[model samples]
Target: MARQTASQSTLNTDPVEQSPAESQTSQEAKKAPAKKPAAKAPAKRAASKTSSKTAAKPAAKAPAKPAAKAPQMKDEAAKADAVSTAAPAPKPAAEKKSLARRKRPRKAPATGPVTIGRSGFTKLKNISEIRHYLRTSDTPVFFVGATAFNLLGLDRWVRGFSYISYYDSWDGTHPRVFCPKDKPYVEFESGEQINNWLLRNHEVRAHIERRTPPGKRPQVVMVFFDEETERICEELDYELILPSHALRERLDSKIVTTQIADSVGVPSVPNVLTTVKDWDELVKVTNKAKLGQDLVIQTAYGDSGKTTYFVTSEAEFAAIADEVVGVEIKVMKRINNRPIAIEAVNTRHGTVVGPCMTEITGHADLTPYRGGWAGNEMFPTVLDDESRHAAVQLVRKLGDRLGKEGYRGFFEVDVLLDTDTGDVYLGELNPRVSGASAITNVTAGAYADVPLFAFHLLEYSGIDFEIDVDEINARWEELASEDEWSHMVIKHTTNSVERIDAAPRTGRYVLDHFGNLVYSHGDLDWHLLTNESEAFFLRIYPEGEYRWKGADLGILVTKAHLENSHGGLTLHAKYLIDAIRGMYRTTLIEGDEPQPKPAPAKGK
Candidate 1:
C-alpha cells in the first residue's frame, strides 16, 4: 500500500535551527559588550561613546542562556551590576527580536476536523474519496473496550486507527493494541464498568495522550458505555463517536424496542407487555391476550438468555418468580423458531443493512445459559430469497425508526424466523457493535465496497457524503449470498472458577485428515481462513485469569457452519470444541469461591 501524506492544515513543522556561522557571530557580539565594559573604571564622566558602540554590535547570543541556569541568570546579572557600578547597555532591536522568539512557547498543532471550503467538500462524495480522506487523516480514532475483536481489522483500512483494550489477545505482538500495566483487581459487574475502569486508568490515559496530536481530540468507540463513560471522555477531551448514552439507555430496554418496532410496522412476536407478580397474574394476562400456556418471559434488560424465562408450568414460574415480580416483562406465546442476527448502521442518507446470518445459541458444550449466544453462521442458504428480503425490510424499518428516535450509528438486531409460519419477528436490540461484526466486516460485500462499519465511521467523521441505500444494500445482499463464514465464541462452561495456568495462542489452528488439531501459524484475525479444515482462534482470557462458568475463553472462526438444520451443534463443531477445550490448562481455586447456578432447560 502507498503511504499517505499528512494533511497540511493539521501538521506542525518545526522551525529550522540557526547555522554554525550565525551562532559564532552572535556569540562574539555578546562577549564584546561584557569585555568592553569590564575594562572601564568607576568614573565620574559617563561612558556614552563606549556604550553606543557596544549596542551597535548587536547582542544576538544573549538568548542562549543554559536552560538549567535560566533562573539564576537574572540574579547573577543583578549582582554584577552592584559590583561594577556601571549600568548595562540596552539590547538592539534585532537582538531583542531573537530573544523574544526563544522565550515564547511553540504553539500546539491544529487537530480535529480540518476546515474545508465548499469546493473541497464536494470531492468527498463516495467510497473512494472517503477512503482517501481517512488514509490521510492525522486524527487518532480509538476503539476502547474489553477486546479489539469488534473492530480488529479497521486499522489496516484507516491510518491512525488503534485499540485500547482490557485483554491483550495479541500478547503485545500486535502493534496497534495498547493494554495498561497491572493494577489491583476490582471485581467488575458489567461491560460498562470494565470500560469505565480502562478510561480512568492512569497508564491508559497517558497512552492516549501520547498518541493524540497536540491540538486534536481523540475519537473513542466502544461496545458498551454509560453516563459515567461519557463524563470520563469529556474530562479527557475525547470525542465519544456514538449516540448519547441517555438515548442508548432508553433504546436498550426490551420494552422500548418492542414499542419502537410496533410504531414502524415491524412485527415482534405475538406478546403482551406487563408486570407479573405471581403465577396467577401471569396466567390472567396470557389468557386475556389469547396467548397460549407455553410462553417465553423476558425482563427488560439482561445479557443473552439469562433474563429470558421459559414458563410452561407453575413449577417453572415459581423457580424464577423472584426475577420477574416487579420488573416489566414481555410475555409471548412460544413458537418453533430459528434465531438470526443482522447488523445495520443508521446513516444520514438511510439505514444500511449488512448480511443476515443464523445465530448459534445455548449449546451446553459452549455456554451454561440455555439461550446464551455462542456464535453465528453466514452462508448462501441461511435464509431463502423471499424470507431474506422480508428480514431486510424489517431491519431497515427498525433502523429508520431508531434514527427518527434520535439514535444513529451501529446496532445489532435479533430476528426470530417462525419455522411453522415462515414469518419474521423482532427478537431484541443491541445498541452497539456485536460479536457478529467479525464476520460482517470480512464478507465479500466488504471486499466489493467497504464494510458496513465504514458507513458508521463516516457518520461520525463529520464529513458529508452521498450514497444510495437501496443500491448498496442490494449489492451487499448479493455478495453475502455467495460468501461462506461461521464463528463460535467458546466460553468456560464448567461450574468451578479456576485460574488458567496455560492457554492456547491466538492464531490459525487446523484439523488434519486424521482428526488431530494442530497449530498452523500466527495470524491476526479469521478473515484469512481459506477452508473448513482450518480455524482462527482469538484467545480472550489468557493465562492467569479466572475461568468461571459462562466466561468467554476464546472465539473460534471457521469456514464452515457449526450447526445442523435443527440448530444443534454438528459433529465437526463438537470435535473442534472438544479439541480446543483440551488445549487449556487451569488450576482449581482454593477455599470459598463463587459457583454459577445451573441454567434453565432449553425451551421448545
Candidate 2:
C-alpha cells in the first residue's frame, strides 16, 4: 500500500480565523486613518492612537484611562485649535462621503442567494427568518460523501439541498439522493478518494450542472475533505463549504488541541506531550509529570482505536515500541472514565452546543478493536444534572477558543467523565462532522427549535443574523432530559473475511414475537421512526458485497437507550445486534482466494 498523503489523512478543521474578505477589509481599514483633529495637542494625538490600537485588538487587556482633566478655557481652546486645523484643509463633500464610507464596516457578500444583488442580502434577524430563507431559497447545496449518514434528512429543511454520494444506499429510489451509475470497483483507502472520484465522474458533473443555474457555483459539502478535494472544487467551480484544509491539518494535532485548551482554561486529562525513544524514557517522563503507572499513549494522528495504546508495564510498552519510539505522542494517566460525545457549531454569534450523549465503545460483538466507538446513546436521565452542566461548559469554552482561532462551523469533541471524581475533562477533538451528528439533529431541542447544524449553515450562508446563544444553550439543556434516542454503527466483528450473499434492507425493522427482526417497509430516513420496536437500518454493504473485520455493515437508529443504567448493553440492544447480524448470510474467504476490495472510510 502507498503512504497516505496529508490531504488524505487529515480529519480536523478550525473555527477562529477571520474570513478572507474580512481580513482584506481589516488591512484596508489600517491603510487609511482619519485625519488628526489638531496638531497642537500631541497628548491628545497619542491618546487617539492608543484608542485605535485597542479597537484593532479584540483581545487587548489594557485598561482605559480617565478623561483628561482640563479647565473650561483649556477645553474651549482645544476645540478652537481643532476647528482651525480642519477649517484650513476642508475637503470636498464627495471626498468626505468616500472617507465616511470607507470608515464604516463593509458588509460581506451573501453566501446563499442574493435577493438584493450589489446592495447586499437581507439580514435574517431571528430563527423564523432563517427557517424561511432556507426553505424558500433555491441555492444549490450538495452533501458529497460515500453515504448520507451524518446528515441524512437535512434536505427537508433547506431548498435545493441534495446528496451526491458514491454508494446508492437508497437503491436509486430516493429523490434527493444522486448516485452515479458509472461506479466501477475501486479499493478506496479514505473518504477523500471516494469524494474525489464522485466529483470527477462525468455523470456526477452532469447531475450538478443540470441542477445549477448559469453562472452560479453550486455548493459542495462532505464529511471528510482535503486539499485535493478543495482543488477539485476549485477546478469544477463549486463552492466547498468548509474551512481551509491547511488550517484543519494544523488543528488535527492532539498536541495543538491540548495547548489551545490550556490557553482557554478548558481542562484536559493530566498529560505530557513529548517524544519517547523507549520504555525507560517513557517511565521517566510519566514519573516527572506524576502520571500513574497506567498510561494512555496516542499518536498525533490516525484513528484513535487503532493508534492509541494502553500500557501498564515494560512488556506492554515493548510490544508497540516500533510505532511509538522517536515519535511525538500524548501520554496521560489512565483513569476510570466514561466518555461522552457532544457536537457544537462555533459561529460569529457564539458557540451553540448540542445535547450530550453517552458513547458506546469496545463492545466485542460490535467491533474487533478495543476502545473502538460502536455507537452513542442519548436519554433524558442518562446523565445527572451536574455532569451535563459541566460537559456543556467545557464544550462551549473550547468552541469559543477555536472560534477565536478563525474556525467558524461544526466540530465534535469527546468529554471524558471521570467516574471516580465526577470531573469532566476535554477528550479528543474531531474538528469535523462526526458520527454523533445523526443523534444530535433529532433531539427534542432540535424539533422544538432548529437542528444544531442550522447554525453552521447560517455561518456560511453570508447573511447577517443575531441570536442569544445563551438562550439556545439553556433551552437545549432543559430539553435534553426530555428525549430518549440511540443509534449504533454495526461493523463486521469477525477476524476472517467473508462475502455477503444476503443482507438486510435499508429501511425500518420491527421485532417479531419470535425475537426476529422483520423488514417493515422502505423508508427514506429515520426521522419518521415512531417507537423503539421500529428501528431504521441504513445499509452500507448490500448483498454480494464483501465484509471484513471492522468493515461497516449498516447503521441502526431507534428510540430508547441501547445502554442500560449500569453502562452495559440492554437486552433489547443485544437482541437487536444479534437479530441484525443474523439477517446477513456470508461465506468465509479462505486462503489462496483473492482478497475482497476495501470499503470507503467512515467518519468517526
Judging by lDDT against the true structure, name the best candidate: 1
* CA RMSD, predictions in order: 22.8, 21.1
How do the residues 1-604 of candidate 1 rate in per-residue lDDT, one tens digit apiece?
Answer: 1000000000111112223321110000111111111111111111111100000011011112222211100000000000111223554676434322111233355485544222244447776666666556777788976667777777766666778876777776666777775544443434555677788776777777777776567799976666667766765668899998768767877788899898878998899999877899989999999998888887766445556777899999999887788778889888888788888999998999999988776789976657756677899999888888899989999999999999889988888888888998898887777777878888888867777888888898766788889999998888888999998777666555455677889899887666677788888667667888889888776665545555677778889778887668888888888778878876555323544433222211
Regions of candidate 1 where Cα sits further than 4 Å from its true position? 1-123, 590-604
How does each model score on lDDT?
0.66, 0.65
TM-score of 2: 0.78
Model 2 misses residue 327 by how many Å? 1.0
Worst 10 residues of 2 by lDDT: 71-80
What is model 1's C-alpha RMSD? 22.8
Clashes of 2: 11
**Residue-wise lDDT of candidate 2 within 291-325, one digit each (tens)?**
97788887666342545678999999999897678
